[model samples]
Target: MRIGLIGAGRIGQVHARSLAADPRVGELAVTDLSPAHASAVAGQVGGRALPTVAELLDSAPDAVVVAAPTDTHAELIIQCCARDVPVFCEKPCVTDQDAAQRLVDQVAASGVPVQVGFQRRFDPGYRRGHQDARSGVLGELRRVHLVTADPAPPPAAYVTVSGGIHRDCQIHDFDVLRWVTGREVVEVFATGANRGADHIGAAGDVDEAAALLTLDDGSIVTMQASRYNGAGYDVRMELAGTEATIAVGLDSQVPLRSVEPAPLGHPERVWSSFLDRFAAAYRAEMAAFLTMVERSDPSPCTVDDARRALLIAEAVAASRRARRPVPVGEPSSSPVGLGSS
Candidate 1:
């Protein structure tokens, strides 16, 4: 299979390497706003660099990976679907709910398979949690807790356009929550603080946040996010049920330290970033995308799925602002100030 990769930035480079190493990908074509950067990535991956999206599409790749900026995601996916090419786009396929809904409608009309990147669904631990939830191994799941914390904040400029903490960072937790439990978030009560960098506060965003979510099945969920987890990039989830409890992201490299006298030794290496922590999951998601392309299967993570997650995020953001609970899927009740890409 031939694959066209859009964007040569950090995440784009990661996808390029994965696609290049895949035996099924016979050719890889890459493009970025910077032609030199695109060329650099293409060279590193033993692929060709295209000057523009049009040029790359002209190469007739079997599929396209849209790792471009968030703002470019909807248009790129639309363009690929128009050409009858499958697409695999990174998370929050569109920044806001309206745009996401429109993209969902357009993709449905096009009948083209487009997978949104939610790598946690492909992670081994999360996958097991999902199975346990579905198979009743964890009987009557009553509660869930999730944490996603970065080792450090992005540049101040990024904060201004990151759509705040809930949309930018916690959306992953939101998506995976739905995926694992097969439950929709009915409501959310959230709060945040600017405990770290002043620039984050200046940008009207928080460095740390927490949310209480109520699922449709009456299960409770608690989520925490941070841009200043000095220990490491920690992302974990725990599901408690009537009969059992399961924990994800409890590996040796987890950054948490116990206070007991006979505590486990601190790991020499810790997950410093999303790329480092979810490397295997990222690769696995790409492989799944390729399988979908080869088999003409429906997208496992559709634009609608992304829209649902965005709705939860929108509620979280509104809850933080209103200092009250916000019902999910009720746009009139939750007026949000969505950030730009």
Candidate 2:
């Protein structure tokens, strides 16, 4: 299969290597705003670099991977759909709610399978949790707790347009929460504090946040995110149910310590970033996309799935500002100003 990749940035580079290494991928073409960057990645991956998106698409690749900036996702996905090319796009298909809805409708009308990248859905631990929860092995999930913290904050300029922590960081938790539990978030109450970085506060964003989410089945979920987790990058989820309790990201490398007398030993090495933590999952998702293209299967993670997760993030952001619970899908009293990471 021939694959076209847009963008040559960090995530795009990751996808380039993944796609290039795949035995099924006979050809890989990449494009970016920086021709040099595209050429570098293409050289490293044994692929070819194209000068523009038009040329890459015109090359008639079997499928396209939209690993470009978040703001460019909808346009690129629509372009791929117009050519009946299956697309695997990175998350938050569109940050703006109305635009997301329109993109969802457009993609649906195009009859092209579009898979949104929420790589956690491909992680082994999260996949196990999803299977257990849906197969009744977890038995009546009672509560869920999720934590996603970065080792450090992004640049202040990024914060200014990041759509705040809820959309930028914790949206992963939101997407995985729904995927693992097969539940819809009905309401959200969120709060935040600017404890670590003055610039984050200055930009009207928080360095830390927490949210309480109510699921459609009355299960309660608590999520926390921080940009100042000095220890390491930490992402974990615990599901407590009537029959059993399960935890993900509880491996030997987890960046956590117990103060008890008989405590577990310190981690030998901690994950430094999302890329390190989810490398395998990223590869797995890309492989899944290729399989979908090969078999003509429907998208496992559809655009509408991404839209639902974005709605939850918007509700969380609105609740943080309003200091009250916000119903999912409710029109925000004020603009949520959805932005991407």
CA lDDT of every candidate: 0.90, 0.90
lDDT of 2 by residue, 1-341 (tens): 99999999999999999999999999999999999999999999999999999999999999999988777889999999999999999886787688888998999999999999999999999999999899998889999999999999999877777677887799899999999998999999988888887888887778889999999999999999999999999999999999999999988778899888626579889989999999999999999999999999989999999888889988988888888999999997545563211
Model 1 spans with C-alpha error above 4 angstroms: 261-264, 332-341
| 1-341 per-residue lDDT for model 1 (tens digits) | 99999999999999999999999999999999999999999999999999999999999999999998887899999999999999999976777788888899999999999999999999999999999999999899899999999999999877766677888899899999999999999999988888878888887788889999999889999999999999998999999999999999988899988888625468889898999999999999999999999999888898999999988998888788778898997673433454221
Clashes of each: 0, 0
> How high a TM-score does candidate 1 get?
0.97
Return the clash pairs for model 1, or none. none
Off by over 4 Å in 2: 336-341
